[model samples]
Target: MTIRVLIADDQDIVRTGLTMLLNAQPGIEVVGAATDGRHAVRLARQLRPDVCLFDIRMPLMDGIEATRRLAGPDVADPLPIVVITTFDLDEYVHGALKAGARGFLLKDAGPELLSQAIRSAAEGDALIAPSVTVRLLAAFADSQKEPPTQPVEPLTAREEQVLIPVAHGRTNSEISAELHISPSTVKTHVAGLMRKLGARNRVELAMWAHETGRA
Candidate 1:
């Protein structure tokens, strides 16, 4: 099945570049483009693409608010969202995930990683590929500690086993191989762990995992 995508950004050039890069992939296509947050949200709701790529800053509504509408807790059915931004700071990255973004990526995160992120989002997997995930998220994650007020749920032994590699940034296939389980089984376990831990995506799971010394 083709992975449908919607691109939302104020810059025409950036939107065009991303659309072109993703379209070149085997099973990916851009369904539409939006120039601002409000339009992005409208197109996303109407089209229901496999993934929505949103920029952080835009007129009428910013990415954060758009993210909340599409994937926030209040939404009856949340759509998967990947936030693409030039700003790669902790606050934006963390904020985007909190607002329900599945993945947070930097704009300069080259074509390969950009395509990979879209594919991952469509697959219900989280990605913060090297060019973006490492340079931005890693530095922040390494420096930060767990929030004092947040108490995480306890994990089962199987969940702990599953989280080990995910916390270290391994892909589902990698985790499956390491755990001697099928990819589908790995995905199921991942979903279960995510719900148990109240994690938005693998990145947040990783943070909570390491904080609990379960990594």
Candidate 2:
């Protein structure tokens, strides 16, 4: 199935480049491109794309607020969003995640990583750029002493097997190879764990793993 995407970036060059890069990929389509956050939100609600790509800094409104409006905790129905930005500051990462962005990537994360992030988000998984994954999660995990209020049911052994590497930032394909399971099976396990743990996305799952000392 084609994964439709809407991109929001203030820079004309960046927006255009992302459009071209994503549109060239198979099974991916750029449904709309917005020059600012307000436009992005408007277009996203109208287009109802499968995934939304946002740049952290934008005019009219910032991507963080836009993400909050579309996918934050209070929203009745949340759209999947991936935040792509030139800056990888801890504040931006934390803000985006809190605002319910399902993925985060650096602007220079390359086409392969960008594509992987889009696919992962489309599949209802989260992907953080490997460069920022460890540090961001560790920092986020360190700031909070209380256990997450999300996880209710305990994880099974098989689920525990999957959780460790995922917390370490392993992708589904990598996890499948390491566990000698099909990629689809990895996905199934991931979905199961997310539901059981009440994780909104993979980043939250990773955070849970760390917070619980399971990683």
Candidate 3:
């Protein structure tokens, strides 16, 4: 199945470039493009694309709020969103994550990273740009005043093994190779961990690991 995408960026050139690039991919399609956050929201509601790509700075509404409306925890049926931005400012990154963005990337992260991010989000996985992952997450981790609540269902030893690598932003395939497990098995463990930890996504899981000194 092709992955349907909605592009939301204020710049016409950037939007056109993204549309052309994604549409050229074998399993991806750019279904709609919006020049501002409000229009993006409208298009999202209308098109119901598989994933949304948002630029942080936009007229009428910024990507942060757009993400909140589309994918925030409060939404009953949240859409998956990936925020792409030129500025790697901690505030923007933090805002996007807080607003329930499944992926975050720098604008110049290259086509490979962008494609990977979109695919990850479509797969219900989270991906942060590697260049900024450790530094940005570590900064957020330091600001936490309290650790996550202990889960009613405690993590098993095997699950703990899975959590460590995942906390460091390892993909299922990477974790599988490291732990001598199959990718499907790694995914099962990851799903179990997310359930036990009450994490909405992998970033939250990673944050919990760091806050609890388990990472």
Candidate 4:
């Protein structure tokens, strides 16, 4: 199935480059492009694309607020969004995740990784750039004034194994290979982790893993 995508970036060249790059990939289509956050939101609501790729900084509104409007906790039906940014600042990462982005990537993430991220988000999985995943999440956890919330129930050993790779941004297939388990089993353990940790998504699960020093 072709994954329709919306691109939102203020830079004309960047937006154009992304559209061209995604369109060149198999089974991916750039359905819409937006120059700013509000335009992106409007296009997203109207197009209902499979994924929305947003830049962190934009005029009129920022990607974080745009993500919140479409995918925030209060939204009736949240859309999947992946935030791509030039800056690797912790605040941008934290804000985008808090606002409901399904994935996060640095602008220089190559075409293959970018495509993978889009596919992952479309498949209800989340990816964070591996280069920044460990450092940024650890920093966020340390900077939190309040202690990380404890899981409702302790994680089983299998679940603990799954959490480490997941916190490192491995996909289900990757984790399954690493742990010598089936993808379905990996998914089951992921779901259990989410339930016990009260995580809204894989991103939150990853954050919890860092917060509690499990990863």
The lDDT for every candidate, in the order shown, is: 0.82, 0.89, 0.89, 0.91
Q: How many residue pairs collide in each prediction?
A: 0, 0, 0, 0
| Stretches > 4 Å off in candidate 3 | 140-149, 176-185, 211-214
Question: RMSD to the native, candidate 1?
Answer: 3.0
- lDDT (tens digit, per residue) of candidate 3 on 1-215: 99999999999999999999888888999999999999999999999999999999999999999999999989998888999999988899889989999899998988887888898788777789876788866787667676567986978999999999988988777788999998778889889988888886787778788888888
Output the better candidate (1/4) by TM-score: 4
Flag clash pairs in model 4.
Answer: none
Q: What would the per-residue lDDT of candidate 2 be over residues 1-215, giving only the tens digit for each residue?
A: 99999999989899899999999999999999999999999999999999999998998999999999999999998999999999879899889989999899999999999998998888777889877888867687768876576556777799999999889888888898999998888899898888998776777788888887888
Candidates 1 and 2: which is better by lDDT?
A: 2
TM-score of each model, in listed order = 0.85, 0.87, 0.88, 0.88
Choose the strongest candidate by TM-score. Answer: 4
Off by over 4 Å in 4: 144-148, 180-185, 210-213
Candidate 3 — worst ten consecutive residues by lDDT sum? 140-149
Candidate 3 lands at a TM-score of: 0.88
Ranking by TM-score: 4, 3, 2, 1
Measured by lDDT, the strongest candidate is 4
Q: Model 4 TM-score?
A: 0.88
Tens-place lDDT per residue, model 1, 1-215, is: 99999999999898898889989989999999999999999999999999999999999999989999999988998888999898867788778878988777888888877777787778778886555445444565577764622435666787779888888877777788898998788899898887877766787677666666666
